[model samples]
Target: MNNYYQVSASYDDVGNILSITRRGLVPDANCFTPQEIDRMTLVYDTPSNRLLRVGDLAPTPYRPYGFKPGVSPSAEYVHDNNGNLTFDPHKGLMMQYNFLNLPTSIGAMSLTYDATGRKWKKDGEFGEVEYDNGVEYRDGVLEAIYAPDGRLVAEYPSGGNRSEGDISRFVAEYWHQDHLGNTRLAFADFNEDSFIEIKDNPSTGENELEITQESHYYPFGMGHMGHGMLLLLQRIGTCSMVLKEMKTWG
Candidate 1:
C-alpha cells in the first residue's frame, strides 16, 4: 500500500504526512469528496514518478441506481508496478469507465496516454460487446478491435470503421498518429448523422470511429474535471437519442 498525500501536502521518506489531509475541508479541501473530486484536476505519475495521465474523476449523481446524488462508491484507482494511482480502473484517464463499469445508457473516456506511450487501445470484440482492447497513442488516440468470445472478429479505427480492411489495415491506417502534435478529436457524420465518433481510447481525435453496429449512435460530451466531476450535460440527451435510433435502425 503506497502512501498518497494531497497535492498541496508534503511527506517524508519515513512515511509521515507532513501536511493536512486534503479531505479535511470537505466542499473545499476535500478534493476527493463527492463534489470536489468531480471537478478538480487529476495527475497520475508512473513508478518512476513521471506524470502518466492528467484528467478528472467526474460525479455520478443522475444514475438511476448507485450514489443518490454524489460520487458513486464504485470508484477505484489503477496502478503500475509501483502502485501509484496513475489511472482509475473504473474511470480511465479521460474518466471513461471500462466495459464492466460503464453505465447501461452512458459512456466514458476508456483510454489515455502519457508523453509518448500507447496508453489504451481497442482490441476488438464480438457480438454487442464481448471484449474490445487494443493500442493507444501518447496524445490519447486509441485503436481497438472487438471479438465476441476470443477471435479477432471486428475492428474500430481512430477515424472510422474499415469494414473492407483486416486487422493489419486497421493498424496501418488508424493506429499510426502524425507527428504534427497531439491529435484533436473531431465528430464524424458517417451516415450524415450528427454523432460524435468514439475511438476505443480516451482522448478524442479525428478519423475515429464507433463500433457495436449502427445500433449505437454517438453521445456527446462525456469527460471529467480535475478531481472526478463528470461533465455529462449533453450526454444524457445524445445517448438516449442514439439508443432509440439504433433500436429503430435495427
Candidate 2:
C-alpha cells in the first residue's frame, strides 16, 4: 500500500487540476517504489474538458504495471475524441467506448449498444466465443449467468448475453435500485463479499486503470462548487470529467 501525505497541485486558468504531485508517498516496507512515485500529470482539451493524456512520471522510472524488470517507463494513457481510452501502453490494455464514454470493449472483447443507446451485447474473443459467462439486462434490470463456451445463450433485451443452462459459475451477484449505486467498480462485483479489488501491489508495482482525478458537486453529475460541500461529486464510479457542471448554484 502507498500513502500520500503532502501534495502539490497545478491548475489551468479555468481551475481544472492539471497535475497533482504526491510527495511523501510511502509504500509498504517491501515496496519497489523508491519513495518517489511522484506525479500523475493529466492533459486535457480545455474546450471539451476531455482528458487527453495521463503521464505518470517520477524523476526517471521504468515501465509501470507488471511489465518485466528494467523496461523503460511509458506515458500513462492515450485517449480518443469520444473520451474512450484507446491505449494504455503500460499494460497493453486497449479499450473503446461509446459516444457516451461507456466502455464498449477492452482488448479483444467488444460491446454493442441498442438503438436506444443501451448496452446491447458483448462479444467474446474469436471462435472461442460461447455463451458460458455473460450478462443480460432488461428494462434496465441486469441479470447474469455463467456457463461454458459453445453452449447456446439467450440475448438480453437491453444488451449482452445471458445464461440458458445451469450456471457454471455463481448466480446473481446482487440486486439494487438504479439510482445512486456507489461502488467504485460500478457493477464489476455485484456481490459485496467478493467485490473485486484491483490493487497496485507494492512488492510488484503492478497497477491497473485507476481514477486519478475526482470532484464532488451540488447538482447531479455536474460540478457546482458554489452550491455546497461535495456538490461536485454525485457518486463513486461516475466519470465527472465528461459531466460538465450544469450551474454554479443548485
Candidate 3:
C-alpha cells in the first residue's frame, strides 16, 4: 500500500515558524486512519528573533512531553552575547567560540585553526585529526584525501601494503548528496565487482546495501537518530564544510 503523509506549519506575524504538524495515514484494522505522527513547536526571543525552544511551549520547567505534552523531551537553546550558541539542553554541554566566531571547543573536543582562519586541527574523544592541503590525518596517520569541492575522494588504510603503488593502496569512495548538499549516501566498491552489492542484514532483518554509510536528515539539516555516518564524515573533514554551508554549526 502507498504511504501517505502530510505536513503543515503555523507561522507567527514576524514570519517565524510557530509550529509544525505531521500526520500520516496508517492501517487501523480494516481501514486506514489519519494519525498525528509528530509535531514541533518553536519559541523564539521576540527581540532577537533567536530560537529559544523547540518542541516546547514555554521556557523554564520543561514540559514532560514537549509538543505532545507528555511524550517526548523538549530542547532548549541558549545563545551568548556574540550570538553564538553557547548551550543546548540536548547536547548537554557548553560551547566556546573564538574571537573570530569560530568554535573553539565543545565538551571534551577542541579545535584549532590556521592563520588564514581555516580549521586545521581537532582533538577529541574520538581522536586527533589534522587537515593539511586537502588531506586529512587521523592520530598522525594519513586518513583521507578530499576534492576541491570537499568531497571524500579517497581513503587510506593504516599499515596497508604500499609496494603496489598509491592508487592501489587507497580505497576510492563516492558521495551522493541531496539538493541541500547533505550527504545522503557514501559507498566504495570493495570487491571490485563494479556493482553495488545488496544483501539481507541479519541484525535489521531487512535488505541492506553494501555501502560505507548512509544518512538521513530532518528538514533543518539535523541528522536523524541512529545514523552514525556523521562521525565518519567528521573523520574525513567533510562534516565541517557541510555544516558551514548549511549554516547550522558554528
TM for candidate 2 is 0.40
- As for TM-score, the candidate ahead, 2 or 3, is 3
Candidate 1 C-alpha lDDT tens digits along 1-250: 2111122434445444333212111232434333222222333343344333332333333231111222433444544443334454334333233334431222332333333442333222321222224422222332344232212223445476444452333321222122432222222234335554555544745445643222111021222223223235444756743433446665
| Candidate topping lDDT | 3
Alpha carbon lDDT of each predicted model: 0.32, 0.47, 0.64
- lDDT, candidate 2, equals 0.47
**What ordering of candidates by lDDT runs from best to worst?**
3, 2, 1
Error of 3 at 95 (Å): 0.8
Candidate 2, residues 175-229: lDDT per residue as tens digits? Answer: 2223454221222332335544444456765544232223332222322121122
Tens-digit lDDT string for candidate 3 (76-97)? 6789898999987655777999
Name the lDDT value of residue 104 in candidate 3. Answer: 90
Q: Could you estimate the TM-score for every candidate?
A: 0.21, 0.40, 0.64
lDDT, model 2, position 206: 50
Sorted by TM-score (best first), the order is: 3, 2, 1
